[model samples]
Target: MLISLMGYSMSINLILILKAILILVLGYFAVKIVSSILENGAKKSKIPELVSEFVIKLFSAILYVFVILLAVGVFGVETGPIILGLSASLGLILGFGLQDTLTNLTSGLWIAVMKPLDKDETVQIGGITGKIVEVGIMATKLLTPDNVVITIPNKLVWGSPITNYTRMDLRRVDVAVGVSYGENLDNALSKALELISEHPKVLKDPAPAVVVTGLGESSVDLQLRAWTKTGDYWGVKGDLTKGIYEKYGKEGIEIPFPQMDIHVHKY
Candidate 1:
């Protein structure tokens, strides 16, 4: 009878050990699979990379906790109360200590909901202009045209003025050009309009406009206004400036520069 009792006890101990091992091994792989599913779903749903990564990591962490609890149960240890106590303690501590962090997190959530600017879009916010690399949990990352990376806290971004250039299909380009006072205003206007119209990127629907906006101290200031695709705005504006410079040289239209007039006084 004693031998049979000892045999039963050994079998129970072995089963408990096996259960712990199985939970640990299976839980590890399970977390990986779930993380992969979440990644694919995020991609399919058009979620940003940073958001998807956060979700997957958070889910995996929660899953690991449960797996650990189950494994501890196999050893006859009660983990529920301990987990609750730790969670409460951590939450209280974090709530009291992480004011700015919490603000950033809340602001980030607000940004996600409002979506004033999206990933890969060009935007100017909080005195920074760049393409959005990621909208992270704590901050938004921007890649500048000069290849600089800027990480801005979500609170600042949410509170600041945001200018999203990519939000519209087209934008207007304005180039203020100046010609010598001796130049014919009508001829300069026609030539400026002609160059703007001939540019491949400039939109014809709005029609290019060349008007004398102001008379500067040195010359007659002509404003050349044109419409182009937002992506081509900078390129088209540069082209217009260069074309104006070349055309004026070819047609005897003098581009006036700042010069001081001096007169000699005889005493």
Candidate 2:
């Protein structure tokens, strides 16, 4: 009788093991089908690749967890206590060690959705200015003009103000020029406008202007304002500045230097 009972127990265990294997196999196929459907839908909706990839990975992780629980239960192991234990452990880790990591992950997801900055766009965030290289699951990568790659946590990026320089079609270049109080005002203004207008990169629709901003102690401070294509902003500004200095020299316009004449009397 004891031998028969032992044989019966062994048969039941074998059946359970086979069932567990089948469940895992079917789960794998289901995950693949769902993932493929998700990819197709993402393409149809024109979703950002980063956001779509993150969603697919998160969903797949959840599905795998469920599959694992189901397989474990088939072996006569109770799942309720296991789930509770795991939940407690996860809560403790998140509350202590993973708080910042969780914040970065969520922030990255939001950043990917909103797209405040895209790859290859110049941006200033949290005082770090660089072109975006990648928006990852937990961080954003930026490549600075100096050829430095910076990895910033998404939590800080999402929290700070984002200045996207390349998103707009046009950007205004402001050049501060100071002329001597002795120079001709009309001649200065006219020459500045003519120089900017003649530049190939400066846009003509809005028109360029040089305006007297203030009267300084030694000179008249003027602002040279012009609009150019976003990509041409820096180039135009640099060229215009150099052109102004050289033009002023040839045209006899005086760019002032600070000077003070001191009077001394013998006591």
Candidate 3:
């Protein structure tokens, strides 16, 4: 009886206004709760944090709009047609305004899914060689060898070929050794093989090969093919080259240099 008397005392219009206000306040709080839950779910998915955060932010915005419409509808506002019309107009405007951004976003999605490259992997892409620091929805961050941070748009990165050096377990080092044409090819070949085998970093399983690749203007070019752990490739090449020079000088092997043999014609 008390509740009925209070309801009758409040004007019907005033009661509806109060109810609308209550719905709006509750909807605002609900939006926050739902946004928080969605953000938590995104984090749990274990994808890139930047991508997940972006996706969650977009989702929360749409949810907030839905909540606002629900609150408005409680006040006897016809929101369905308004919402549908506004959504189409807004979509068109946003699509045109954010065309470039959408391109990068789609490219980022492809990167996340295709995964041709990954974080912490050293790669050369789009003329930039560096270690991937972070892959975001708009751009990817890389730490270059010189310690400079480079941000490349995901669209450009996705369009280019990525060279991942660290992807392979082993790498082959090719060093060209030239000996005087007069030097015995057999002796030079043996010396090249010996130098490669003696190097601790060179993998003995491949059995370093020395072959006559070409004859240069002044020397017979010998190509030394050696396999080594990718990490040790440079070290092996440098150390073995030094060994070749020292060994050649000791064994009287000649490394030919540029010189022209002048033929004199006496008439």
Candidate 4:
């Protein structure tokens, strides 16, 4: 009788193990199918790629946790207690060890929803200027113009002021130039305006202008302001600066050097 009882118990245990394996296999396929569906739906719904990726990953993690618990239940484990214990442990960990990580994650979610910045957009945030590579759950990646990669925590990014340079359709270029105190003020201004106006990239709608900004100790300071398409901002600014110096040289405008005189008397 004892031998028969042991045999029956062994058979039941074997059946339970097989059931657990089957659940795991089905769970794997389910996760795959659900992930694919979510990805396609996000794309079809015109969701931002950043937010889409974050949502998919978050859902996948939760799905995996549930799948594991379901598999464990086949062996007569009580899932309710397990889930409660896991929740308690997660709360404890998040409250202490992962506090900063939790902050970044929440900040990342806010950024994803608000979209203060986007992938490939040039932005200045937290005193760093770069093109956004990716906005992850905990941090943001940036690729600087010099080919350096930077990672910033999302908390700082969300808290700081963001300057997106590429979002605007047009930009204004301001170039400062100085002239000798003795040069023809009106002539210098006219020449500077004409030079900028003739540039192919400068916009005609809001005509370019040169205005006297200040008088330095040795020279008069002027600023050349022009509007151009955003993409041509840097190029236009550089061209205008070089052109001004060359034009002034040919026009005999002397850009004076700073000088100071001292008088001495015998005591």
Candidate 5:
């Protein structure tokens, strides 16, 4: 009779093991199928790739946790106490040790949702300027102009001010030009405007303007302001400065240098 009871117990244990294996296999396939469907839907919609990927990972993690719990239950294990114990342990550890990580995670979520800077946007955050490549759960990836990849933590990104250079379609290029005090201010202004108008990237609608911003000790400072598309900002700015110099030289407009007149009185 004792031998028969041991045989029965062994048979039940074997059945439970098989059931757990089957459940895990089925759970994996179910998770895959659901993930595929969601990904397909996301692709078809206007959702961003970053957001879609995050959603899939989050759902898959939850499903995996469920599968683990199911497998534990098959062996007649008390999952409630196990879960509670794990939760308490993790909570204590995470609360004390992972505060910064949790802050970064929360900030990343906010950034993903708010989208202050989108993918490929040129931004200067925390004194680092680069084009945004990926916004992840912990950090954001940037490709700098020098071809270096930079990773910035989400906590710092959220805490600092972000300057999105490409946020607006139009950007203003400010150029400063100085001329001799006796030089023709009106002629200099007209020549500057004419040169700015020649640039293809400079917008014609707003109309470029030249203003005498300051009267310096050596020369009069004139600020040339022009509007151009954000993409053409740097090129237009560089070209505009060069063009101004060339045109001024041709028109005999003197770009004055800083000079001070010193008088010495013999004691």
Candidate 6:
């Protein structure tokens, strides 16, 4: 009788093992089928690539967990207590060790959703200026004009002030030109205004304005303010400076230089 009982226990264990293996195999194919369906649906719906990728990954993780649970069930194992214990342990560890990571990830999600800056938008954040290349889950990548790559933490980006240079379709170019104290301020101002007006990239709606900003030590400070398309900003700025120099020279507008008089007394 004892031998018969031992034989029955062994048989039951073997059956359980086979059941577990069969469940795992079935789960594998189920997961594959679900993933394929998701991909097809996403493609038909014309979902954004990033959104589709995220959805697929999320579903895959869910399917993996389900497969594990099914395998455990096949062996007559209780999973409720195990799941509770795991959740508690994971929460405690993540709370302590991954606080900053979670913060960055949340902030990055917010930025992606809000889209404060788009790809290729020029932005200045955390004292670094560059064109946005990619915005990831924990950080943002930038490509500087000099071809340098900069990665900034999402927490810092969300916490600090961001200056988006290309936010507006048009921007104002602020240029300062100085002339001799005794020169005709009117003529200098008119000539500077003319130079700005003649630039093809400069906007005409707002109209360029020249004003006396202040009196410097050796020259009369004049500010030339003009509106230009954001795309043409750099070219217009550079050309405007050269144009100012040449035009002022032709108009006999003297650009004063800093000078100091030294006095020496011999006793």
| lDDT preference between candidates 1 and 3, better one | 1
How does residue 197 of candidate 4 score in lDDT? 91
Per-residue lDDT, model 2, residue 249, is 89
True-vs-predicted CA distance for residue 163, candidate 5, Å: 1.0
Sort by TM-score, top down from the best: 4, 5, 2, 1, 6, 3
TM-score of each candidate? 0.77, 0.78, 0.65, 0.85, 0.80, 0.74
Give, for candidate 6, the lowest lDDT window spanning 10 residues. Answer: 1-10
- lDDT-best of 2 and 4: 4
Model 6 agreement with the true structure over 1-267: per-residue lDDT tens digits: 112331232224767778888888988898988889988998888565445544576578778887888787664456787788778987998889988888887887678656687688999998899999987777889999999999998899889899999989999888888999899888888889888888888888888888999999989998888898999888888888888889999988999877788999999
Give per-residue CA lDDT, model 3, range 1-267, as digits (tens): 122331233223666767777877887788789778877887788776555655766676777787777765654556867788798987897678878788888898888777777788788998899998988778888999999999999999999998987778898888887999899989999988988887778888777899999989889999888999988877888887788888889999999789778999999
4 versus 6: better lDDT goes to: 4
Runs in model 2 deviating more than 4 A are: 1-37, 48-50, 63-81, 259-267
- Per-model root-mean-square deviation over C-alphas: 6.6, 5.8, 8.7, 5.0, 5.4, 6.2
- Against the true structure, candidate 6 reaches a TM-score of 0.74
lDDT of 6 at 117: 77
Q: Compute the lDDT of residue 22 as modeled in candidate 1.
A: 100
Candidate 3 differs from the real structure by a C-alpha RMSD in angstroms, to one decimal, of 8.7
Best by lDDT: 4
Clashing pairs in 1: none
Assess candidate 5 and give its lDDT: 0.87
Minimal lDDT window, size 10, model 3: 1-10
**Best-fitting candidate, measured by TM-score?**
4
Q: Tens digits of per-residue lDDT for model 1 on 137-211?
A: 789999999999999999999989999999899999999889999888899999989988999999988888998
The candidate 2 region of ten consecutive residues with least summed lDDT is 1-10
Candidate 6 overall lDDT versus native: 0.82
Cα lDDT for residue 131, model 2?
96
